[model samples]
Target: MRVNAKSQKPKTPKGFIGPIGFDLPSIMPIVFAIIVFFSAVSYSYTTVNEKNNVLDSIESSIKIADILKGNSYLFFDATDSGAKNKFASNCEKAVNIAQSKNINFAATFVKLDSSSSIEWLIENKESEIDSCTTADGKHLCWCGFSPKKFDSNLSKQFWSISFPVTVDVKPPGSGPEDIYPQSYLRKIIVVVWK
Candidate 1:
């Protein structure tokens, strides 16, 4: 028997089915949620990277301050005139390095004789020097930064603390009236916003 063409149904092609459809309202929320999740992740990553960079800069500043302390000792040990000159040159070299690296520092060499001089040095330089104290009429040479400004977010996020170094000196004489030649090196570092 011949099949009737008028009653024949069309056949669907294999492997040509379209994507399944869902209600737009139901699918939109999921898509939006995925987008929001990715956005939050990207933002968090960028923030972490920025904080790490700030931390690295602060660490570098501290290391540079320590290097300056070592140079100060070398300066103190140079007794000969020529050696002293060389020491000064070395100090300049260290200073250049610090500047090149964007590390800020201030240094002073003080010879303690009387309480007046010690007080004077402390009064004039306390903001920069982390600490200054007098003992046996000897003054301390201190190197440090004046004021520090840091990233507020990083500071709060990491719970960081400030710890600075201070150098002390001992005088040869016993009384405040006598002068002393002994001195020591001190270092301090502060992280501030530029």
Candidate 2:
């Protein structure tokens, strides 16, 4: 028996189209799935990034509070009023260092009176020391950046911590018999942002 070559070869059906590789219906689902997957991944990444920023801000704030309380650069021997130059220099340096690390820092000293009123000594500048009176009508000085400087419109994470600190304050123009400076307990608030 003779085999016909044309009969053995494959033949296209009548009205048959070209290859189905470019078919829209089959490609639509794949495109949709890919879009969904990428969207989910982007959202997850953004959420994680925001959470990390917040955690970093909190950690920095805590560390800054510890430094402010423990370090002698800002205040030596708990004497905030006597070390103005040293405080200013250290304050500027600390701020610059924090800024270099993409973090913002500020600290202030406050005293609460018996009448539930707050006395604030906000830091205005490195050279300018803001003074506030404690409950006992004693002056207290501090070196820190003001919280007002932080813009409300900026989308940044912020963290703050406040701790009690005992500071030595000298009465203005004390007599010869006044050899010891009065001790005042105050709060030091440290704020960090990114």
**TM-score, every prediction:** 0.40, 0.60
How well is each residue in 1-194 modelled by candidate 1, as lDDT tens digits? 99998669665457544443435666799899999999999999999998875786566555544454553343222122233233335446556765676655444443222223322333355422222233332223344343333334634432111233333322222344433244343333223232
Off by over 4 Å in 2: 1-22, 71-93, 112-140, 147-151, 175-180
Error of 2 at 94 (Å): 3.4
Top TM-score model: 2
Among all windows of ten consecutive residues in candidate 1, which has the lowest summed lDDT? 75-84
How far off is residue 23 in model 1, in Å?
4.3
Residue clash pairs of candidate 2:
none
Best by lDDT: 2
User: How accurate locally, in lDDT, is each candidate?
Assistant: 0.43, 0.57
